[model samples]
Target: MARRTGLPAVEVLDACESTNDEALRRARAGAPHGAAVAAVRQTLGRGRRGHVWVSPPGGLYLSVVLRPGVARECLRAVPVAAGLGALDACRALGAKAPRLKWPNDIVVLGPDGVRKLGGILVELCLGQRSAGAAGDAAVCGIGVNLTRPRGDGIRPKAVRDGMPAPLPAAYLDECGAPAAAGDYAAAATLFRDAIVRRVDAWAAGLWKDASAAPLAPVLEEYRSSLLGLGGTVLAVTPEGTVVGQGTFLSVDGTGRAVLALAGGGTLSLAPEQASLRPLAR
Candidate 1:
C-alpha cells in the first residue's frame, strides 16, 4: 500500500511467528528503513515479560522496521509515540476516542469501565553493518481487535470490552461496520504518519513541538483516561513487581511516567506491566 502511494510498501504476511520478530529479522538482514511487515495472525505473539498475546484471527497484527540515526537515549520515547499513533488510528476508525494507558496499552470505555483495545511491543536488535560498524535496529509490533474474540481465559472485563460484534465475513458486507476496512486503513495511515513525523522531530530535537508538549499533556491525557488512577495496583517490571497505591502524577519530558508510591518512594516507570485492582472501599 505504501509503495503504491510512493511510500515504502508494507510487507503483508498471512501468518507469522510474530510480526515484530519478522521485522527484526528483516532489519538485521539490512532491510531498508521504513519497511513494514503485517500478519493476519501471529502464531507466537508475545507481550511484555514473555506473556502470550491472545492473538487469533480477526485482528490486525503488524510491525514496522526502523533503522534510526538518532541518539540511542532518545529511543525510549518510541513506545509512547507508538501509543499515541495507535490512539490516533482508532479515532480515525470512529471508535470512541481511545485513551492510552501509560507505557503502551490502548483503552476504551465500556459499560463497566475502561478496558484494553490494543497493545504494542518493541524489540531492539544489536548488530554490525557491512563495514563491521556497530549499529542497532528496532521493530515495533502492534495488535488491534477488529472483530469478536475467540479465546478463553482472558480477563473478563478485557474480553468484554475488547471484542467487537461479528458480522458477515465478506468485505462488501463489512463496509458499513463501525470497524470497517476503510477505518482500519485510515487508522493505519494515521499511525504511520505520526511515527514518521515524530521520528523526524526527535531526530531534530524538536519532539516537544511535534508532540505539542514537553510531556505534561501526554501524562494528563493518559491519567485522565486511566482505569485505576489513585488506586492500589501492581506495577510490574522485568526486575520485579512493585505493589503500591498509584497516584498518576505526570510523564517527564522523555515520556517516563512518574508514580507516587504509598510507602514513600516515588517510582518513575517506563513500565512493562500495569494491572489495576480495586482497593477496599
Candidate 2:
C-alpha cells in the first residue's frame, strides 16, 4: 500500500501507531531504498527514548527506510547527518534556522524562548539485511510541529526562583519564510525529500570511505547549528534523573556529547545513554 510521490514511493496513512513502525515493516518486506511512510495521525508517535510524540494534526510524521550497508561500527554517524538534513530542509521551508540538539532535536527560538520544533528518532534494522545484502539499513523517523499557535511542545522547564517551567517547543510556521507561505503539505514534502536525499548521501560516506563518510561538510553544518556551546546543559540518563550538568561542548566524532561537567571534569556520553538538555536562562 505505497503511493507514488515526486520524491519516492511513500505510504500515506490516515493514522498509525508510529511511522517508524511502518517503516520497519516495509524494511522487513524488503522495501527498496527511499521507501517512506507518512502518517497524517500517529496514535503512538514517540521520540529519543520512549517519550510519546504528540502527533496532532498539522505535524509531519514521516519515516524513511534507508539501506546504507555501512559496517555496524560506523552506523552512529547517520543520525548526525540526518539532523543536518532536517535542519537544512526546515530552514528552507521557513523554520527560522533551528539548532540541532545532539543526537536529534530540531529547536527554534520562539516568543516563549528556545523550544523544540521537531525531533528525530533513527533506528537500525539489522533483520532487514538479506543473506546476500550489501549492508545495514535504518529508518529515519522525523516529526515536526507546524503552525503551533498554542503554548509549548514539551513540559515547561523550571526557571530559577520557584517559577513554573516554561514550555519547551517552537513551531516552524513562525519562520515566516516566503517559500513556506504557511503551507503544511508543501513543507512536509520538501522536508521528506531533503531527509531521504541526505540519508543516501551519508550512507555512501559512512560505508564507502571510513575517513569521509558523513563528510566534513555535513558535520560542519551540523556543528555550526548545535545548541548551547559553552552554556549550561543538564544531562538526564535513561535512569530518569539528572546524571550530569555541565557546559555544553562539541559532539565528538562518535556523535557523543562532550561536556565540561559541572563538578569539574570533561565527560563524553553517548546520546542513547543520556539526554542532554540546554537549560533555558
Candidate 3:
C-alpha cells in the first residue's frame, strides 16, 4: 500500500488518455483540492503546447488538482514550485544533481550530455469568482521516466526537423534510482507527495498577505538548481518563432524567464509565452 500525503483522494488506473485530462474533469465536477489521478500508461499524454509525451508503461504519469484562490501573479509560480518538488523527489530517490529546465523539464547531466528525466505541465480551470478572490483550479501534471522502455520502450523520441532520429532517454534506474522501477503506484504516490508539498507551501505564502514577494524563497530555490543559467539560449514560441535569444538569467518574482539580451536590453517571458532552448555556441 502506498502512503498518503496531503492528497485527499488518489485514483490509480491501468491506462488513461491522460491523467491531466481526468484530473481536470474531476476538478470541474467540484472535486476538492488535493485530488490526484495517476495511470500506468497514457494513450493521449501531452506536454506544454500540445506536444505529445511518449507515455510508456514503465513511466510514472500523475496529476494533482490544486485550488489556490490566489491572484494570477502568484499562480504563475505554480510551475516553479512544482519543478522544485519534482527535483526534491528525484534527489530523495538518489539521482544526483538533477536540475530543473525552465518552465517544465527535469533533466540529469550525464557524461555525454544533459538528458531529460521528466517534465511537468500545469493547466488551469477557472472557477466562478466571488468575494474579491481568484477562483481557479490548476492541475499539475508530472511524468517521469523511471526505466528505459524496451526498444523504443523507455527511450524518449527527440524532436527532429525532417528526419527520424531518437535520443537516448534518461532513466531513474540509470541515475541511481533502480528502486523506483517496477512499482507504478508507489512511484506515483511519491511524486504527488513531493510536488504537492511545495505547492502547499507556495499557496500558503500567497494567501497570507495576498502578495507574491513573500514567496521569494521558493523562487531562489528554483533559481539555484536551474539548468543553463548564464548560457546563451533561445526563447521559442509555440509556433516555432524565436521570441528572444539571450544569456539565461534567473527567473523573476512571478516565475518569468529573465534574460540579458546582447543589445543591452532584457526580456522576461512567462511560462505560457515561450519555451527555452539552449543555443549552441
Candidate 4:
C-alpha cells in the first residue's frame, strides 16, 4: 500500500479475490472517499450481472470507494461519470479511439472485430450505518487487459441476444499502451481523479435542482463516444431472455439506454435492467 498526496491511499496487492470486494470491505469499515485498491491478479473477479471477469497477470484491476453527497436518485449517474473517467484513463494510456459500450465496457475496433479492452462494475454497499442512512458508498471497479496473458488466450463467455457468446479479449498492449504494473497503479490514480471531477460536477447540478442540465455535458460526450450508436441492438437480461431489440440511440440523462424499438416505440433501460448486444442490420 502506498500513500500519495491528493490520492489519499492506494493499496496495491500482489493477489486478491477481487479488488471490488476488498474495497467494499474497507468502505464498510469507514474508509473515506478516494480510497482505492488494486491487484495484480484476482482469483474471483466478477462483473455486472454475475459474469466472471478473467483477471490474469499483466492486467489493470482497480476499485475506488466513492461516497458522493447526493440523493439516492442521483446515484444512477455515478456509473456514467465513472465510465467517462475510465475512458479518459484509457486514452491517457494510449488506446486509440476506445469506444464505451453501453452500461460499463470499454472496447476497441480491430481487424478481427470489436473486442473488449476493459470493463467497469459499480456496486453500491452499505457503510457503517444501515440502509437509507447517511453512511452509504459505492465501489467503482475497473479492469483493463494491459497485456496478453500467458495461456491458451482469454475467451471469456458472455450472453448476447439471449445466447451465450464467447468473447475474445483485447489487450491494451496490442494498441501500443504501456504494460508495466507500476504504470497500472498510475492509471488507477488517474481514474480516481477523473471520476471525482465528473461526480462533483454532477452533484452541483443536482443540488441546484437542475434536472438533466448538469448531466447534459456528460451525456453529450458519452453519447458521441459510444459504440454502435444508431445501429441495431438487443437488450438481454441475465437469464438470457431478450427484453428488447431496436436501434441503439443515445444513453439518456439518467444513464438509461434509449432504444428505438422495431415496433415504433422507445425503450429506456437502466444499467441493471439489461446487457446490450449489437446486431447485424
Candidate 5:
C-alpha cells in the first residue's frame, strides 16, 4: 500500500527519449519545483559519464526538476545525497539491503555476487533559464530495473574486471531477494514514490543549508553503505586510461573518490576523472 502522495507531482508517461532531458525542458518552461516525469521506458537513457543505459519496458525510468538553492561549492552534495534516496526506494520493497558505490550507484550484495540495482544522474543549469523561472535547478534522473531487460550486452551476467556490471530484474531479484509481493505494478508505484520522497528531501536541504550541513546525514549513511572503502581498487579514466592502483578510501565532501596509492601519495578523483574497479583481495 505505498502512496504516491509525496511532494513533486509525479507524471506518468508511456515513453521518452530521456527523462532527464524532458524534465530539464519542463524546468526551463517554468515547471513547478519537484515536478517529476517518469517513463516506463526510455529510448535514449544515459548514466553518469554518458554511458548508455539499457532502458526497456518494466523498469523505473524517471526524472525530476528541482531548485536546490545551495551555493556552487555545495552542489556536489546534492547528487551524493541522492544515492541515499535511491537506496531507500529499493529498500521499501523489502528487497535485500543495497550498498552505495561512490559517486552514485545502488548495488545489491549477495553470496552470488554484487549486482547494480540502479543509479542516480544529477544535472545542473544555474543561470540559463527562461524569463521568470525559479532559482538554480537540477534535473535528477533515476533508473531501476524492475524486470528483465531487453537483450543488451552492457549488463553482462558476470562482473567485469571485478567491478559488477549492471543487470536487469524486478527489485526483488535485482536486490537478491528470494520473493516479493505478487503485484508488480503496485510495487513499481511504491518504488517510484519512495525515490521522489527522498529526492525532495535532499533538494530541500540544498535549498536551506548554507555549509551543506544537510549532506551530513547523507555522508553518514554513505559511510555505512559505501562498498569498497578500505579495499584495493584500480582507477581508470573515462577514456579507459589507467590512473593508478590504490586502497579505496572514501568519497570526499565534493563527491570525489579519495584513493591512497599503494606505493605512496593520495589522489582524489571526480566522477568525470575516473571509474574505480575493485581488485581481488
Candidate 6:
C-alpha cells in the first residue's frame, strides 16, 4: 500500500521480535518516513509500560515507521492521532460512535458499559544524533480484535460487540465498509490516513490548529460513544492511583488528557500508563 502511495513497504512472516522493533531497526538503517512493516504473528508483541501485547492468529498486527521533525514534547500526539484513526475506521464500518479514552485506547459502549475495541503503541527509537538534531524516528504498532479467540483470557468488563456492529451502520450511513477480511484491515487504513494527515499538517508547521482541531470532531463522536465521561472515576497510574470526580475534557495537542479534578485541580495525564474506571460515589 505504501509503495502505491510512493512510500516504501516491508513485510515479514512469523517474526520472533515485535513489528515495531523491526521497523525501528529499519528506520535506523535509513528507512525513510512512511515505511510500513507488517507481521503475520508477533512473538513478543508489546503494550504500554512494556506489557505483553497478546497476539493470536486472526488479528491484525503491523507497524509504521515515521520520522516527524518535532520537539520531543509534541511526540505524544501520535497516539492521539492513532486513536482518531481507529475511531474513524470504526465509524466508517458503522460504529457510528466510538470514543477514544485517553492515551491510545479505543472504547465503545454496549448494553453492559464501555468496552475496549482496540489499542495502539508508539515506540520512539533514539538514533545517533545530537539532542537538537532531527533524525529521530518512531515506529507505531497497531493491533485490532478481528476474530475473538475461543480460550483467550477475557476481562470481566471487556465487551465484544462483534464485527457486524459497524457493517450495518456503514450500509445505512456510507453505503459500504472498506473491503477487508475484518475490522483490522479497515482500522489499519484509518490509522495510516490519520498518521499521514497529522504528520503532513505538523510538517507544514500547523501545530496549534492541528492540535486543537481534532478535539471538536473527536469529542462530538466520543460524546455518543463514551459510556462515562463526566463522573467520579479512578485514575490508575504506575506511580499509584488517584480517585477523583471529573469530566473527560479533551485530548490535548501532546495527547495528554486534560482532566478536570473534583476538588479544584486540573490534571494533564499521559494516558499510556493510566486507566480510567468509573468510581462509585
Q: Which candidate leads the pack in TM-score? A: 3
lDDT value for model 6: 0.57
Q: For residues 17-75, what per-residue lDDT tens digits would candidate 2 score against the true structure? A: 99999999888788877778888778888877676677766677888887766666666
Residue range 1-281, candidate 1, lDDT tens digits: 46544557666677898888888888888876567777777888886666667566666777876655544555665666567666656665566656665566666644444445677787877664453212766677777766654554222223321123111111111222364344444445455655554444444543334444334334445456555466554455443444456665555776656677777778776554443332333
Which candidate number would show the highest lDDT if scored against the true structure?
3
RMSD values for the candidates in order, in angstroms, are 6.4, 4.4, 2.9, 2.9, 3.9, 6.4
What digit string (tens of lDDT, one per residue) describes model 3 on residues 193-232? 7887888888787776564463474876888888888899
Task: Put down candidate 6 lDDT per residue, 1-281, tens digits, no spaces.
Answer: 54456755445455546888888888888787777676656778876777666666645577877777665555655565555665666565665456665556665544556556566788887666575326777777876554445454221212212111211111112213333335444445545655665555544453444454333323444344444566665566644445444766655544455668877878777665465665444
lDDT, residue 270, model 5 = 82
For all candidates, the clash counts are 0, 5, 4, 0, 1, 1
Between candidates 4 and 5, the one scoring higher on lDDT is 4
Relative to the true structure, candidate 5 reaches a TM of 0.82
Q: TM-score for all predictions?
A: 0.73, 0.83, 0.89, 0.88, 0.82, 0.74
Clash pairs for candidate 1? none
Question: How displaced is residue 86 in candidate 6, in Å?
Answer: 2.7
Where does model 3 exceed 4 Å of error?
Answer: 1-6, 131-135, 153-168, 213-217, 279-281
Clashes of 4: 0
Error of 2 at 4 (Å): 12
Q: Which window of 10 residues has the lowest lDDT sum in candidate 5?
A: 159-168
Candidate 1 local Cα displacement, residue 174, angstroms: 13
